[model samples]
Target chain A: MASNSDQQSMDVNYIARLARMNLDALEARQFQTQMDGIVDYVRQLSELDVEGVEPTAHAAPIQNVFREDLAQPGLTQEQALANAPAQSGGQFIVPKIVE
Target chain B: MSAARYEAVIGLEVHVQLKTRSKMFCGCATSFGAEPNTNVCPVCLGYPGTMPVMNREAIRLTVLSGLMLGCRINPRSKFDRKSYFYPDMPKNYQITQYDQPLCLGGGVEIEGASGLATVPLTRIHLEEDVAKNMHFATCSGVDFNRAGSPLMEIVSEPAMHTPEQAVAYLQGLKQTLMYAGVSDCNLEEGNMRCDVNVSLRPVGATALGTKAELKNLNSFKSVLLALRAEIGRQEQLLREGGRVVQETRRWDVEAGATFLMRTKEDAHDYRYFPEPDLMPVVLSEQQIAEWARGLPETPRQRRARFASEYSLPEYDARVLAADKAVGDYFEAAARGSKAPKIVSNWVMTEMLRRLGETGQEIAAVQITPAALAELVELTEAGAINSNTARELFGELFANGGSPRALVEARGLAQVSDSGALQALVDQAIRENAKSAEDFRGGKAVALKFLTGQVMRLSRGKANPQLAAQLLEERLKK
Candidate 1:
């Protein structure tokens, strides 16, 4: 609900940290201005009457569209991991994630 | 303060894999235990330029499940992208229902210690299941066979206070879903999984306390054990004047303890947005009605019917109604016989015992419902004594055959011919003279001894009723 000027003062560094991204000082300033403009555009809708208006989730009017539950041939083991940067023993290898 | 003064608040989120033939959005087969990565497609693998098309059967099943649970199906629902990063999720974002779920506002009734308690449900949403991740000593493997399978996420209100109630609620939910044919709900095969949220508050407090989320609960028994351990841990901390932190805890099955996984601050910020590739689902009144008509009778309705129609005890009806396969089998067998209780007894005792010993499902049992009913009828008509019937049951259980034919082929039919039994009774009276005299001298146990002699002569095939009549008639003379 904050105005565009209020959003401009928002900390871009904190947001970047939450998103796990690193940004330099000039990039942070640039992102802050861009975010402020995006927030301002979304904020304009708040002035309109939303009472009794069901929110729209999709642009199309269709619902319940579905395909039959039929199985078709799919990729082989090699093709499945083809996009992986690292692979070992027919599996995609990533940095170890401790559980 | 004593731990007794504190009560636990519990809610569960259960993820059940629907029994659909294909993947939720692709043509890949949903069969389990297939070769790893064999079921993957470009759509499920999250490759560029791939669009998802919803599976109609999955939608029908979700609606049917909602109807069975007494939920209100939303006229309009759409999928959302829950953005996150996990090795199991190839797309790096899961297509789930965020604000507009398919079903809302339902409750499952569980039998608590006091009586029936209704555990209210918050919502039931449809989503695609992530792939399974397997960990080894040195490396981890991901299987895409389970990915894109139709998964239903059911969230419950924090209405349960004890572990027993939680387990009961789970059992009730599982029974309902199974009856509706929504899912198999098998725990070991990962068809169903549960995450538990629990917190303890003073007995009289109204506001809820900070709750801890327990994950990796594979079975109902594990859910109970994990809750007990988590509740104990919380109580001990509170009793020592410490505050319980709100965090996600991993339940270590081998260690039998809950360990800190992550705090609330470390939770994933799932930037949810509407899935643009798929269309919003709109349901017409006629479509809803059609789906409703196809739903099977609920477990509650079946239990009531079993009691009235079959004349079964309430306990028996409850047990039979808990599983649809068992209930259907009972009905099929009972329909052929007048004595339904007899059929119920066999199913509950001998049939169930055999199933347990052999580790076979009821559907896979050798004895069909009609065959079971025939055995019951033979016993009821006195063609075979109860003892011989039991022995025949063991044979029929081991190797399938008609009871009537088995009785005839094995010479197990009762010797009820009056002329044939008269000779056995005379022989028994001639051999055990002291027993005969004791019977005439008013010793009642001597009559039993004579009956045993008649049974021994006939090799346990003699009709004990006619033998007793013949013995009493000769004793009077």
Candidate 2:
């Protein structure tokens, strides 16, 4: 993000935490170098803006694609929980959720 | 530094579950209480290559609600992906509208204040609701039946100063949405949920204070209690030279206070970005107008109209128009009736009382408005005394039938004919000579006792007005 400096720094630990990953210091430092390169390229692209171009949300210029409100048959209980690592009483089970 | 000098500033974020037939993006049925994961599909479960398509009815219904609330429709709005990590949503993010929401700048009219006032709205956006998590001994089970159901969030500005005003705002929105047939708005059934932000500032201060967000206020009573407690807590802390922290709190109904849930998170943490999978939603004026057509008048408008049209008192109009079904029933029974005030009294007292005691819905009650009107007319015409009409009312209320047919079949009509009344008047004079003689002896109160005798002699069908007049005339001689 410090585009003016000759060398940029990236906080890989912060990014890894947001992505729900646990990494060692060595791996974090290595990933930080790779992330710095990615950010430098993005900083270069950010310098050339026309100031009048509209921001596009999607690549295709389409709108208002909708389906009717009729219900369609979805998966059965067996099919829905088929790939769960843990299951009980026909439901997918995870570790106890607390507030 | 006085506690009484501090005023509470409050705002609410309300979420209402739309009564749609299918999910917001996928075709899974949105039925509540279904078995766990039965409504799951790859599109809602966030599987690869599964994209979302909008549901037309959900969009139309949300727009209709916006129109009823007097919001401006945006011509172009797009979806944004709000990044978060939660087990309820499989994609680790939620598809919502951040900057470009669908409707903007509406107000809800609340009258529980000194007079009618409008609480200004920030915006209303449509999104998908998450799944339900039920905890067991060591695990939490996921039920995808509620996932991807259409949910509408209405955000209000920090315009409320008291808890009652916030509740009035919620009730106002509930009535309008229910009248529009967009939702049931049943709070106990989890159809409507609310979160409130509260802060306190000194009286006559222009600046705001740090706010705490309160959740799990399931009912209006709890909202009132929790807010009062939280306001007291903040005032005490401020008086003791302590600072209020910005945090999220959960209401404990049993404890009568709010406990800290978490320290507040910054908005930047969500990292919202435009959704790449969804195209921008562009609506035309023609489409907005078409959606607005045939929308019912809001509850506020209906309350005002009922006061003028039916010549009812403000109290009657307020109570009647609060519920859609009760308002419709009143209009049907009161239309073209000579005594609308009388009709209003009966509805507010007898009909509502019976409905409450019997625990029956107004729709399921066997009494038709036309039948009820006939009973009122019969009493007004003196064809049957009010006492006899009330007896017939009980039967008609329990079982549907014509009041006229029931009265005719039971021979319950009053003896208004002079010849038939003369016989009963003479029999009353013969049976109760003491009351007749006392009436003749200049005791005007004796005529009421004589009339009772005539009513008893006529088997409770004697018109009290005619009987009193006859007794007075006969005793004068």
Candidate 3:
């Protein structure tokens, strides 16, 4: 379902706003070109001869992944906080979470 | 609207995090509420040159979910890599089940008129959860704590036709998972999240209409409200001869409405392929059956057993079995000391009220079922009057002491000694003469007030019924 070229740009910008992505002028112009390319690629995929081809959603060939329910030692606070950029009062601290 | 005027169709995808001790594909702990990213390792963090070793328990839990949901377990299933780029997704590709899922063609039974109605389950597959994304003004932060977590995604057929039916299906699914001990099913903690697919058609339409996907419904109540709002929006479009576009929407609980997010065409391509790092999983039927045998009694079966074995009312059985801890509490209390019905009363009324007031799940309760059973037994045996039992229950919850011990230590037990109660009743009659005369004249409430006075004289320990009888005999003379 392709829309008019001029109208599609407006819609895309609106969607970018809804997703809270602030695309600058240069990024918007680049995205317009990229969007057209992606639209063409998907259109080509739709044209492939597939009268009865089952759609594949996954690519991995693995099954039966699980773990036993047993008690195990967990990471200590010091070890857990080793990678943090900041820590305080035995808790990881970032900028205040909310106003 | 009348049933003949509209047709409603619904399908649900429920994501459940398995309650295993370790991650799905690694030995990293699966526990939640740890310091952020503490449990992560190279495998889970998607570090280069590291390969994932499939956890056997993750597979077992997936097959078990399929069995409990009434699905056909695929002896052979494969994991695929779903390609995506996001800050929370460090690898840019997630290991998941795609074409060949672990369980296919399964269904769960929901309560229907007369009995249980089996809802056809389309598929139950295994997947990995993404990391948490915290948005800032200029940038976004990522937490790898949830990344690589084991998730089972269950898809149901578009068979549910009403909001109530959708909620019931969700409840049933949660119950089955909890009963199998596969998950804790805590919605608030994001252990259970649901996405609903809803479509509307004409009253007699043979084929389904365009469907919209709604996401981020954190609670069961929100699911119902979101679906209802979507259904209403779709009906309005149809009645006005407008087209209903197939798209993904997000429910804003604060606004109480659904907002269009994006169309299907703009959706991510995913670029799914066989994960190069992991191997295909194969399970034996005997192996699956063993896991199935170990499953705890599912909520549906437990509800039926509670009704027939304990002779509990249908509503009581439903409420008691709503959660595993609540059901266990009822069973422990009813088994040895008090009758089932009496335990049900205190639990349904006082215990439930207190739990709700404190906003605590039965699992977090300090009062054990054994303690509650003793409390019920004390009240039923008249060892303590109803008021004293109520007071003692408050103390038991607050102090974490045994019900019997608290009653004994506080001297709150009923005074069954007839001589002691009658003397207090006599003292009460002598204290009030005109009110005693009025009791002889025919107002029965006056004697009730006098019984209260005698209870006060005994410091709230006198047997109320015996005190009332003694007061009536003395006033009649």
Candidate 4:
């Protein structure tokens, strides 16, 4: 599934910024080559002539899965904030955001 | 500067909370005004490894709304995750329809300045509501009670040109959703919220200008005012040789001005991906047809039918059919009465006035439709006069009672008996001999004066027509 050597290069730093993550220069360079290899491997599927095939969103053939509208009891205030790293006055506290 | 030289292009995105018992993906009560964070569950709280199950009722209601708005319900639809970083959204990504929406291409007919105009709709999609963020002085609080609630986003095309048309379009949409029983559409409770997009262009221009999105327009009035302020701001900028930047503005309701919130560059790139937990919704033609057939008559259809079936004027039908409760009350009363116009008059003038004064809903009125019908019938039968009916309506509105029973108990029955009214008439003629002589002398005003005296003597119970007849008969002698 290896791609030709002349394929377009991937920009890992740009993609990392979009995902709101920071990566050093060395890591970005290493991830760029690895991501290129993964993309090339996945691109091999384009060789097949499956023109009439339907695009599937899920792997399993399932539809119309739903739940009833009846309400059940949920978490209390204490339990809801149990996993919070910081808390104040029965609320989860985080860094202040000003806009 | 001539305001007429510029045309405003406007579109609206409305979010209506579906009236479901539970949240969209979990078994948590969707009731508003509950204690903060009480409705939070594992799935809604975005806890790791918790999967969401679609609420069937929410999907049904979304389809119901789509049908009411005349939208084409996509037979195959699926959900996608819209990624964003907002504190109110517990998941940091809202599960909504992106490329494939549930409904597409509908129009709402509004009474525009020129006449009836149809506001074209772009799409209607289903999404999960986020938690409410309440800002305070020192810190902000979050209420997860509204989190994960079912919300439908109805996006309109840039068809509205004026603030008035936008308001009309919103009102028409609200009426249709309410009639469909899919949502309460209460703005005060935050069940319905709007986002407006406004742009300006030269009059008769072919291309559209850059648009600024308006936020925090909770009420219809705010939507109108915000659009007006934004349009003015844009026009002023253009006239000053400055360009209008595409940004989001917040409407300062108190200051009556719009302030810049964020620019297009700051817009979040909602990296969307198909939701894997929930299965795709594949509806059959038979199912869609069945749902469409079972839908109630839309507000517009009801308005038209009210005009033709009840023989009411367009104005009367419009006002009556604007609200479902009012329309139902009018129909119930009209069905009982022979004269539908009489019923319309009572409802439009008297009933609506009382409703406004007491701040009562039509369904909560003390006077039932049957009672009102009975009152109208009594007035038409000459059992009670118009003045007496008005008084009775006031009493009935204050305290519930049957019009017939009240009339009988209060002794308000009109005195149509010639014997009783003739006695009263003879006494009035004797007491007002000068006026009787004046009447015989061909002064028509004197006859009215004599009848006033007879009515006063009879305690207003005298049948006016019979009293006039008896007075003329006595005058001839």
Candidate 5:
């Protein structure tokens, strides 16, 4: 796959627009060069074909993972709100939620 | 209009939140009243480096729920990732059962009003709940409290031909889950939610007509009403020769209309793939046996038992078994009182009425099952007259007092003494001489008047039957 690089050219701005992203002219021209190189590098990964191999989606080999219906200790009010940027009494204070 | 020629095809997908102590795939607590997000952990929050380990309680509950619904348990099952884009979704993908569900090919039996029928269940799968999203005008807020909760999604085949069957099927399913101790099944608290697929076709068409996905029906009444309104909407379109569009719609309870939400997009494919993070869920035969043996009799079986045990009418049995609290109370009282119909009557008429008046569930009632049994005993032994019993019932319901104590403390017990009642009967007959003469002249209604006078003389404490008997005896003299 890496040897057969036909050097196909495409418009980067067109792809960005389709993805609902706005890019300036200078940024588009610069990204066009960078993305083409990245795509070319990823194309090399196709050469190692293991057609029957399964795609791994997660890390753990464990299945049917579950916990019993037993209550456990939970965070205390002090610990729960320890990292809050703003706190009032026992609650984390935020902007008004209701209209 | 010419005899309408249309058929209503209905299918239901019910989501029941399983009563588990922890999240489906994490150790976060699955409690409702916990502070928002307090029960959450790194796994439920979808932290980048964290991985999920399924909760055993969730699996056991799922299998227990499947067996309760008469579904065949799948020996081999696995989880999949259903990808979607929503702010409420912490991982932008949900771990759910696909291809191989926990149970399949099961059904429920729901009785039609005029006859009996059965609804076929398509499948029951286990899944994790998404966080709750509250969309505001300018921004959206997400509550992670509900995230990672264990949810069992049961889909029914589109076998129902009428809206009434649909509602019955839903109610039966709710009661069944409740009996299994798998869920509270509270619609008000969002423990159970429904999405209905409805379509209307020509009278004899073999193929299904276009379907509209009705979303988020909050209550059972709303489910029935939404289905009815949707049926009308589809039939009118078909009659006008207009093709109904395949789309999703929201049921506007206030407007009583199904408004178009969105057209069916490229089939959500969800790009579902087996979750590699989890392993295959294999249940041992011994494990299943234990669960099955410990399983209590379902609502349907218990309903039949109640019918035979109490010799109650089918309607009364249904009302009694509608809620687990009421059904358990009825059984408890029946064992102590040995009068099923008598207990059923009190529960249905007096107990249910008080529950309604207070806007509380039967479990919320202050009166204990023992108190209820005692109350029935008092009534059966003629310790309290029927009228006095009704008045005492209110006191017991309001203040939660013992029936015997209330009767004695208030002097509300019936005066069954023949001497005392006979004296009152004589006084009534002498005071109402015209009524006495009318009774002798074959005016049968005059006896009822004398009976009423005797009751008034005893201040509603007189045994009504004894008063009537003694009054008739005095009139004859």
Candidate 6:
């Protein structure tokens, strides 16, 4: 399993970039090997035949769980911004976004 | 090719914030302009391990809007996670209906230069709006009060050829949504925002040209102006042997031109997947039927009904049917009145003007429809002259009361009795003998002077027509 037989390598660099992660070259190489091993382990599902089965997002067979559209009191401005790393005038401040 | 040979093709994607009392997935108030971040909840704030519970009212209103626009309702719709790294979105990914939106095929019927046409719709999907980001000098502030509000994205097909049709289409969509009571659709208040994609192709070309997306067009005027400028720029570019590039341009309202909004970013690859926490919405036929029963008349249908039921002209019907509240007001005021045209005129002119000047909504006005109807009836029946009726109308519009009662209390009724009118006319002839002499000497202007005297003697209560008739009898002698 460590030697990796005829399977193509996973693009771990692209995946990390999509996740907004900064990986050093060594870390990228290491993650490629580990993620390939993980993918190989997950590929065991290919052995099963799922052609006729209906694709499902939820396995519990439960649907239409909704709450009434009634407003209950939420966090006050003080409580809401309490967790922010930065705050200004009861709002969370960040770097300017765009023009 | 001449500039006229190229036709502009435009399509709009409008985002409307649904008018619900609570957030889409949480029980936070959706009221606008509360203290910043006051409406925040764990679910909308994207706290870890928080699960979203769907708002049944948001779903109902979305389906109702679809029905009002003649869309086919999908029985089963699921939410998908769309990834965006923007800070405006508290969650890294947006929960939107991708392949299974609640509503499928509908069209907005717009009245254009060719009379009436339906701009075909691609789809309408329900999604959650993001937070409000206010950019300051050095830092941007994020307010989560707007997060998780149910927002509807209505995508129109690239079927419009001109900017006029595009504006009409957007107006029609907004009117229908407002009529359904789904969203307020107020452009100025950011209740509705639009993005348009435009391209120009030479006449008789089958394939489309490179399209440019125009953004930040908040108002209908901006939509029209931005589309025009984009179309003009593209046409001029193509005619001058340049190619139209595909990019995103934003409308600079100050400059009245479109400028490149952003540098081309990396290719968007939103790794969309099914949302696992919330379950799919499965509506039964009976449930959809119950909602369909509550669908209000669309703007087009309401306009047609106003024309037929009230016998209003086309222009009046169109103006009256523009707003559902105004149309409701007009209908209630003209329900049993014999003079609907007169009522329509007053509603269109006086009522709308006052509401506009005072920045008030039709529903918040002091005047009641019954009072307006009574006022119109009084003026029509000659119980009060037109001038007196108008004066009383302002009084009634400002201070709500019975028009008849107000007229009686103020002694403003017209003096149409023959005996009282004859006495007033005789007094006018005797006092203004010079004017009477001029009238007998074949001066028609002097006769008008005598009528004014009669009106003044009765304190503007004399019926001018009857007073003129009685004066003619006396002055002839």
lDDT per residue, candidate 5, A1-99, as tens digits? 111234575467755653447999899989999988888788888899879985544465655555466655545556655665655544444444431
| Ordering by DockQ | 2, 1, 6, 4, 5, 3
- Superpose all Cα atoms of candidate 4 onto the true structure and report the RMSD in Å to 1 decimal: 3.6
Model 6 complex DockQ against the native: 0.47
Docking class of 4: acceptable
Top candidate on DockQ is 2
Give the C-alpha miss distance for residue B72 in model 3, angstroms: 2.2
Error of model 2, residue B71, in angstroms: 0.5
Better of 2 and 5 by TM-score: 2
Model 3 chain A worst lDDT run, 10 consecutive residues:
A1-10
lDDT of each structure? 0.89, 0.86, 0.80, 0.89, 0.82, 0.89
Q: Judge the docking of candidate 3 as incorrect, acceptable, medium or high.
A: incorrect
Every candidate's DockQ is 0.50, 0.56, 0.15, 0.42, 0.22, 0.47
Ranking by TM-score: 1, 4, 2, 6, 5, 3
Question: Against the true structure, what is model 5's DockQ?
Answer: 0.22
Off by over 4 Å in 1: A1-11, A24-30, A41-53, A59-64, B422-446
> lDDT by residue for model 6 over B378-398, one digit each (tens)?
988999887788788788778
For all predicted structures, in order, the TM-scores are 0.91, 0.89, 0.78, 0.90, 0.85, 0.88
Which parts of model 3 have CA positions greater than 4 angstroms off?
A1-99, B1-4, B34-38, B47-49, B111-116, B204-206, B308-311, B427-459, B471-477
Model 6 per-residue lDDT tens digits across residues A1-99: 112234477787777877899999999999999998998898898899999998888889899999998999988888888889999988899998875
TM-score of chain A of 2: 0.81
Query: Candidate 2: lDDT of B320?
Result: 90
Q: lDDT tens string, model 2, B1-477? A: 655488899999999999999999999999888878888899888777889999999988888889999999988998888888777888888888889999998999888648889999999999999887888988898877888999999999999999899988888888889888999887877889999999999889979999999999888888889899999999998888788999989999999999998885632367688888888889999999887777888887888999999899999998899878888888898896887777777778778988999978776789888888888888888889978987887888888799999989989999888789988899889988988888878898888888988999888898889888887787777
RMSD of each: 3.1, 3.6, 7.2, 3.6, 5.5, 4.2
Docking quality band of candidate 1, CAPRI definitions: medium
lDDT of 1 by residue, A1-99 (tens): 112235545677777865678999999999989977887788888899999987776655666677889999999989898877867766666656676
